[model samples]
Target: MLIRVLFAVLVVVSLVLGYVGLAEYLATSAQYAHRPLDLLYYDLQLFVINSAPVSNGGPYPWPLEVSRFLTPAVTAYAVVEAARLLFASEIARLRARRRARHIIVCGDSLAARTLASHLDAEHRVVRVESARSPAPLIAAGLPRAARLYACADETAANIATVLAASQVERKVHAPLEIHAHVSDPELGDALRDRGWREGLEVDFFSLDGVAAKQVIAAEQPDGERLVVIGLSAFGRALLLELARRRTEPVEVTVVDPDGEAVVAELAARHPFFAVACHVSVVPVYQPEPGVHLVFVCHDDEERALRDGLNAAATVDATRGTVIVRMAELAGVGEMMVQHGQEDRLRFVGVLDMASVYLSERITDSLARAVHRRYVRAQRALGQDVRSNPSLVDWDDLPDTLRDANRASAGDIERKLELVGCRLVPSLEAAAFTFEPEEVERLAVAEHERWVAERRADGWRYGSRRDNERKLHPDLRPWSDLGEAERQKDRNVVLALPEILADAGYRIVRR
Candidate 1:
């Protein structure tokens, strides 16, 4: 009789527990169901407990004595029912996202992964075809393109997958962006011929005749660093010249405020940029020559840059120190000439807005032209070169800065905001703690490389003789090349080392 009673109790407990779970499951999908159980230690109660004690026991707790028969079947039914209700929509949601918008990437490289992760998740993506993956760089940036040209991967097979999966004809985006070789030189082009407008973006994956110039150094060496600060919008072009002309570097730092990332990235995996780049806050104080370049943003920024540099730089006239100021920047280039002559330092003014505006690669070619002109102009000038003022007295900097600020102390940030000079803060570092030597050397090496390569190629110098005359120390050695040259190269990438001469920065080269 005791055994029979225990068995009956067990049956009653199962019926009650199963009923409760079903009620909770029914009201909402099991995905949405949650609540507290009756007991403290037993709050989790996966199974039911018999609350009735010895006082007056009920034979069975369930409404029907036959509920025991259905207990075993209830467990399986409730579990599956809850899971289906909970996850059915979730599965459908993912599939829908994949419908027309999803992009299936195929490379297993680190760069590919990083680019994918940083992109917006809503931009559906999948790595469906990566086995012995063909190059996929061309297709990677399409989803980010500003204009039209996106792949038309309807419900059929994915354009990325088909091209990568050996079913090349099925790839809707005609030109498959293969990070590696596409194997067939004609394949990328053939797809376009066959009505698919797919083509290489040229920043990356354009193996043949890609205008391949934006290299890092001569011999096109790898891993050299470049930090360029252009005073105008032309800085963007300067970056392209460096990358295409030099060899790949470990890393290149481009100080540009535009959206040049696509160009920077595809050409070299190691390229970095200092966004919103501007000239130094102070004038190139005691502008010297060598690896460092101190440039003012405009004629207005000139005094600010000059005052800042003069205040910060050291000066020594006996050593022939000179700080060159570029007045051609705006209409105020004569500021360098006036300061140089008054200070009795080596000061020479150039009619050279063109040289200042040349792209790094293009300017690299201007050396022969520069050398020839300076040589010719020097002989014709009856005045002495020694009379040039190369160094700006360090003691004079405080007053100079204060005075320049008084005249026009505005920075480049406010002016170019419309042309998207928002990246100025990159140059306007809150705490500029870098040792000048390292950054200077890096910039000079890059400039020399850029200049040297152009010299080798033999570029055209428009007015070599005319520039030589104005570059001379007789006050205006290269006056003819002014402002016209300003629109040529953007700004001087090579800062004057302590080699400031009266010819703007002659003393700095020492």
Candidate 2:
């Protein structure tokens, strides 16, 4: 708007100057340029061609040249400036359309929006709706996107976005990274399975899980009595994480109106709650001295803040800390850091949870990638990387292999998720054993997977184990394999649950 106004003023001033200059030249030289049509024609000719239609017999030649040049220059400048201002939005869109290797964030949910905010500083971000169809993706500049985040509120919508993005052929040479927001364990497993089977780079994460881990890590409530308000999804996840982290038995008193029902249901789903930690359910919060940490995680933002503040007020400021889950941290900043108050009050917003979740996602991806590289390098040297007992530290690997390993780790994790298996040493205790016949099928499935991976790497069917530096070079039919080889295969299949657990997944069933 300002550009248009400035140019308009310039155009009017130029025309007036041109008219006045031509009139003065005619008056001083007795050229009779005072006739209105003649004067207008002469001004127009000067502005267009920097030359008057008739010779300006003015006394000063320089003044005539200045008038001619100034009129045309100002008029051209006004036209160009007006066009640029009028089409500014369209020009920006065009530039974005041509850009590649940018991040595309799907959905308008709080988590998605928050995640985008963190990434916006380092990457170009485009937001799109979570539609089943691919039109929204294309409209959101998916073809140019290097990373796509599927963070819709609904699990189904997130899944759809990931699937749609996976099928998109990015303009860049590298595969597009698809990060999906997953709150449910089951949904995460399913998406991971799809990624493994198809070799797509899809990641699943939950802000609730991120929040739980972060709170537990910060509080470090080891063997300390704690009070947790609300038994919502976020609350249960936090309780479960706390129980997992605590080495010593700690009493956790859960408070809410329907605490009993929530705790009972959650305990059934998660066995650690019953075995590792002692927990009690109550209808209302009863603040006590010596409380190590108070987590007010009610779904209602205002109530949670109020409850946390009230609990902090009752507790001795030096011993206990109150943490409140709020939608917006700015609204109640004063309560978080009360002036002249000893009780340390902390506020955790959804955006904070989202930020933690994204950071974890990157960390997990990189770790898995590095591990994958380590295993692959071992395999190339004829070592059974999968069966190797030692766990390799990702940080120990060299920089050259880090990127390749990260990519391969994504593939390996996807495959691991697809088989509904993982390598947990405690998996046998966690999962029910299958029938002998089913166990045989599991071994055969692993054998088939091994064969497929070998074939993909250009290994042919062979049985010459002497010359070839192959760990399992005897590529004969599975039926012909010895009992020892078969047993090892079966052991690998049985370890699936533990492996899944290690990858932040809970294997509920064998």
Per-prediction TM-score to the true structure, in the order listed: 0.23, 0.60
Write down the RMSD of all candidates, one decimal each. Answer: 26.2, 14.1
Best by TM-score: 2
- lDDT of candidate 2 at residue 92, scale 0 to 100: 58
Candidate 1 C-alpha lDDT tens digits along 252-336: 3333344354344434532332231221222122333232222222223465345334522533333322223232342342463
Please give the lDDT score at residue 325 for candidate 2: 76
How many Å off is the CA of 454 in candidate 2?
A: 32
Q: Candidates' lDDT values, in order?
A: 0.31, 0.65
